[model samples]
Target chain A: MIQISRLPYYGRQMLNWGVTIASVIVCALILPSRLPGMELLGIGPNWLLIWVVAWSVKRSVLQGAIAGLALGLIQDGMTSLHPSHTLSLMCVGILTASLKKQRYVQEDFISVALIVFGMTVVAETVLALQFSLVGDRSLAEIWTDHQQIALSSAILSSLWAPILYYPLNLWWEKMNWIENNA
Target chain B: MDTLRRWWDRNWLQVALIGLVISTAWVARQTQGGSLFEVYQLLTRPFQSNPSKQELLTNAKVVEMEAKLQQVEKENQKLRELLGYVAKNQQQAIAAPIVGRGADHWWQQITLGRGSNDGIKEDFVVTAPGGLVGRVSSVTAHTSRVMLISDPSSRVGVMINRSRFMGVMRGKSGNKAVMQFFERVPDVRRGDVVTTSSASELFPSGLPVGRVESVNLSQSPAPEAVIALSAPTSVLEWVAVYPVEKNTDSETSQANSK
Candidate 1:
């Protein structure tokens, strides 16, 4: 196979885009599946939320929000549109980006997982708030349900964050190095 | 003007990419992610449960019970025909494998391998061996999404089969759903069978939903009962999809009801 490093700058950029888009597609595909250990109480990890968190960390606030919005719309397409997923994901992206992890935390699995855990709860809460605003479902029920969802989603997404984060982070870091050197 | 020009020139590629991505996602949302699901269906086709393995899993006892149930159903049909009762037109059901579960934690949904290619349409009734599963929420060319009766947003008009007490049942996000009765003191008891009532415009009446687990008669707004859904939604492998017989009355009622 031809070495990616030897390719022209434009070709390298195109490859970076290809890798990023492929990761998003993979996350989307994995969202609907319940692979044995990945599920808890019939709930799976919030893959899209994890993806948003991953993409948002180390990116600008605007870039993070855009990533969130795009993924959220895709999620809405996968599920119902009334209580849209966009708001929650957008919030996650914005929050993650604004955290400025370089100031306080180091680039490690534990910290990244912690951020994902916190973001998962935030995302679920935002969704619950949207459900409340819709008024179709009872407020009591929404919050009560939110507790279980947030807890499980946080746990699962946190535990699984590194699986998605490590590779994507590596690729983006390499791309950044290549761009700076070129 | 020079600074603005420089910024635009520098960020033009990023701006174009972001716009393209957002517009693509917008198109996906408008089409209910039909293309994505089609790709998902294609990718998952190899992993779908095999029919032969499913057959092996069904033991002889369940088959015997199914045979007996069929006999009783046939007899009940004859009796209803003898009494001149208007028989419901039985539509042929298409069997589909459960290819996926809900994409998110909030919704209780299932993705079936069959779709419009198999004549399944939106709002079609989906049933499993145990009872009513859900209704088809959206359909792609080769895949369809079902909004399960267990979804929190789903509300079904149901009645106690034993007492004929009408109520609206709303899913509580799992196997259990809470039913609020129309009457102040409905004569509902534990273990009573609940089925879709005639007032439900979205579903055919008399389809089995679940059994009442408990009743709280003195509760606040209205009397409520917790129902354990008969369909094993979480573990469902295969389901039957039947076209809903749409009428002008139902359409008007669906609009007026909710």
Candidate 2:
């Protein structure tokens, strides 16, 4: 916002990275809190999942996978480690990025929300699968939990996708324009 | 070699950034996100629960304490006659604000503002006004994470206070848990109070856990009961933490009996 176009090339790059990293940190911090309007059934929106969908929607598959891996590791730290979050998030990243490549959906708020809804289900299912394979819990219990979690998370994440997507999309668009013009 | 050098020049920064991010995340995972919780605690310090809520919690605490006193008194009379047992002095409790809930919905956990700095350590028992909440799982300098009894993986040795029937309780998500009894035809009924038994090594004995919601005696090899946890795990504003009294002799005796 502060005349990013007027900055030196390296300065602009630094600002871009800073904003990107800061947004991820904000998502991480919000992951554990349940604010008044952001909660449903004691579950909050999956901010990291939404962020992964947002990032992967416009990036290469490799980049998306990397973002997923990093965020998933951080999420594992915040939660437990036995059923790692990396595989599920990485699956989300790759699926979303490839969905973009196949030209299945256009770029818009609704489309992004739809992608997030589907991807949240995908991510949660992957986690449930991991839990099943871990064999510490009953298969029926895991799937039952999967149903509740996936539905609520998909609904909340899709509904709130715009709040995160619009801003990040705008910032990336502005950064792209400035870089191309320079 | 010329083309490779050109490619390196074009993308060295991106590669380096990716490496840095991955390594940072890996380090965070290894430390179990201790530094992240520390920062979260600092940021949310200003937005803690209000004085009005604290007052409500205090009033609830008083009623719960009286109920707990009545239960303990009844249990004490029975135990003294059966085993000639003597009660030990209780340590002072450290009260802490509930800072956050579980990071993921799948895990039922809570982060407390007070930590090792305030004498809270791993496995320290946490209780709210109504009853047992959980135990401290990990601790940073000023923050500690408590794994709520509602998590699927948490297993606690519990018993019905009325009949002295022993069972193993596992979380069923939300504010409910499933307790499986050792004896197939154990004496249990709806509305029976459940508390921690001496068989549990992770928590102290006799802490109130929940109340029996229903009993399912014919379902399986071991009779099971559904317990509705007394602690309002979803809306807890504050909790009291006490150090676990090491009862090695009791633990060994319980193990021998098993």
| Interface RMSD to the true structure, each candidate | 0.8, 0.6
- Of candidate 1 chain A, the 10-residue stretch with the lowest lDDT total is A2-11
| Per-candidate clashes, comma-separated | 0, 0
Ten-residue region with minimum lDDT total, candidate 2 chain A? A98-107
Candidate 1 runs further than 4 Å off: B246-258
Most DockQ-accurate candidate: 2
With a 3 Å backbone cut-off (N, CA, C), the pairs that clash in candidate 2 are: none
Q: Give the TM-score of chain B in candidate 1.
A: 0.91
Q: On residues A1-182, what C-alpha lDDT tens digit does candidate 1 reach at each position? A: 97778899778877888899889989999988899999998889999999999999999999899999999999999998878999999999999999999899885798899999999999999999888888988899899999999999899999999999999999899889878877
* True A-B contacts kept by model 2: 0.75
Q: Model-by-model lDDT, in order?
A: 0.91, 0.90
lDDT of 2 by residue, B3-23 (tens): 999999998988888999999
Backbone clashes in model 1, listed as residue pairs: none
Off by over 4 Å in 2: B50-53, B56-87, B248-258
Instruction: Output the worst ten-in-a-row residue range by lDDT, candidate 1 chain B.
Output: B245-254
